[model samples]
Target: MYSFKSRIRYSEVNERKTLDLSSVINYFQDCSTFHSEDTGNGIDYLTSQNRVWLLNSWQIIVYRYPVLFETIKVSTNPYSFKSMFGYRNFMIQDENDAVCVVADSKWIYLNSDTLRPVRVAESDIASYGLGEKIPMDYKQGNIILPEQRVSKEPFPVVPANIDTNHHVNNGQYIKMAENYLPDQFSIRQMRAEYRSAATLGDVIYPEVALTDTSCTVCLASENKKPYAIIEFIS
Candidate 1:
């Protein structure tokens, strides 16, 4: 496992002065990226080889969100790799070593040019040797759509939503889904499934479904095909 220690920054917090859900995802994403960089399989190498890793799904469970200025440790480890897919775990711990958040994620290795799944090389797998899977009731990547949903006004994908791959960042989709959440709804867990990439100029028509215990948001194209589906459990 690879880890990093840092204090929760003001910019990372929400109006409640605590680290927000999107920042937590960013930390986990960065931790894995840092691990790859240190292992000599970073951006430069991946770009040179025309290879990239696209997040397929995320399952994050938060025990509590850390407040601004709080010191915390973020860690991540790849637990398994199969063909074009990789499985990983992430955790955020407080200064006292109590875990505040844990997440399991699935990613697909891809050919950058083709944007299609590709088998990860043996060398790449060796670089990040498998670690023990963390404790979490892992869910499948597929998210079940609610029977009833309401459509929101369509919005264009903005520049801030795009990542290095020129598609909407995985965390951005979660942030987008949060826009439709109930006021003061506290999320204990979040799951997102990326169905397709949404790039600049693409219009997103959001469809939201709510229940007593959860909210589901499907960020879809104008034609109703999903770019991503996110579920927030309160």
Candidate 2:
């Protein structure tokens, strides 16, 4: 497993002074990139080869949200790889070694030049020493929306929303969904399914369904086809 230690910055916390979902997502994102770089398969190497990694899905469970200035250890490792897809697990632990968050993510290797997924070299996979064990045994399940939503908000993708991929970053989707949630609700767990990419100038309609303990948010087009579906459990 590849590991790193860091403190929760004040800017990364919400009004409650606790880590937010978006920041949690960012931690996992950064740690994976760090791991790749440490193993000699970093972004520079991939870019040189005209390839990139794209997130496919995320399922994260938060047992406790760390507060500002709290030190935490973040770690990740590849658990499975097949064809063009890779499966990895991440965890955030407190100073006392108690787990604060656990996550499982799916990713696809893409040929940047062709914008299509390509098989990852077996030798590359061997270097990571991929294992069969999955942390938290977290499964990203299907998110079923209610027949009728409680609210809807429409917004355009701005230039700032675009990432290196020239599309909206995956973490932005989680932030968007969190914004639509009630202020009293705290996300204990979240699952996001990225169906399609949204680019600058594209307008997305976010529809939300609320329950006593959960909220389901779908980022869709005006015609109702979805780009992403996110579920938050309090």
Candidate 3:
């Protein structure tokens, strides 16, 4: 497993003084960076060779919320591997050892130059020494995975929303979720699936609604199809 220390700075927390979803992203990113280094093939090493890893999907289950400045140990371990993609399982625990968040991510290896997927050989996978090929059977997330339920008129696709590859940057979607949740309540946990890409001309209609304590949002297509699904648990 890989781990990192957290400093819950004021900037990292929401108005309620707890780590926000964006901070959660930072925690996982730090752990993943460590995981890569521990495996002897960090981002710098791979990117230098024109290879990059792209995120495909992620699921987060929150058990508790960490208050401002609360230290945390974020850990991650490789669970399974596919052809060009694999899964990473992670956990974030607070000072009391209570699990703050549990997450699993799907990643795809790509040729940075061509932006095309590539599979790593057996030797490369062994270098990580992560042990035990991920079984095809591991279960995660809630059943049915909470589908995207609604949408509305499309909005202008601004330049800031665009990223280096010309697609909408992912974190902006989290900010969209933040707008829906009341400033007083905190986001206990969240799970998101990145489906189709959103390009320059693509208009966006982010639809959000609540089911019980869970808030669901869907970035809908002009034709009413879904571009991505985001759900929050409180």
Candidate whose TM-score is highest: 1
Model 1 stretches with alpha carbons more than 4 Å out: none
TM-score for each candidate, following the candidate numbering = 0.98, 0.94, 0.79
lDDT of 2 at 80: 88
Give the per-residue lDDT of model 2 (tens digit) for 1-234. 888999999899999999988999999999999998888888898899899989999989999999999999998989989899999999999999999999998999899988899998986666677756555756646778788796565999998778888889999988888888897898988999988889998899988888899999999877878889999999
**Residue-level error in angstroms, candidate 3, position 47:** 2.8
Give lDDT tens digits, candidate 1, residues 29-122. 8999999999998999999999999999999999999999999999999998999999999999999999999999899999999888898778
Q: Please, what are the lDDT tens digits per residue for candidate 3 over residues 109-143?
A: 88888878899778657866564332223346532
| Pairwise TM-score winner, candidates 1 and 3 | 1
What are the runs in model 3 whose C-alpha is more than 4 Å off?
37-40, 131-153, 156-167, 182-186, 199-202
**Winning model by lDDT:** 1
Which stretch of 10 consecutive residues in model 3 shows the poorest summed lDDT? 131-140
Q: Candidate 2: lDDT of 174? A: 88
The per-model lDDT (C-alpha) reads: 0.93, 0.88, 0.72
Q: The CA-based lDDT of model 2 is what? A: 0.88
Could you tell me the TM-score of candidate 2?
Answer: 0.94
Which should have the higher TM-score, number 1 or number 2? 1
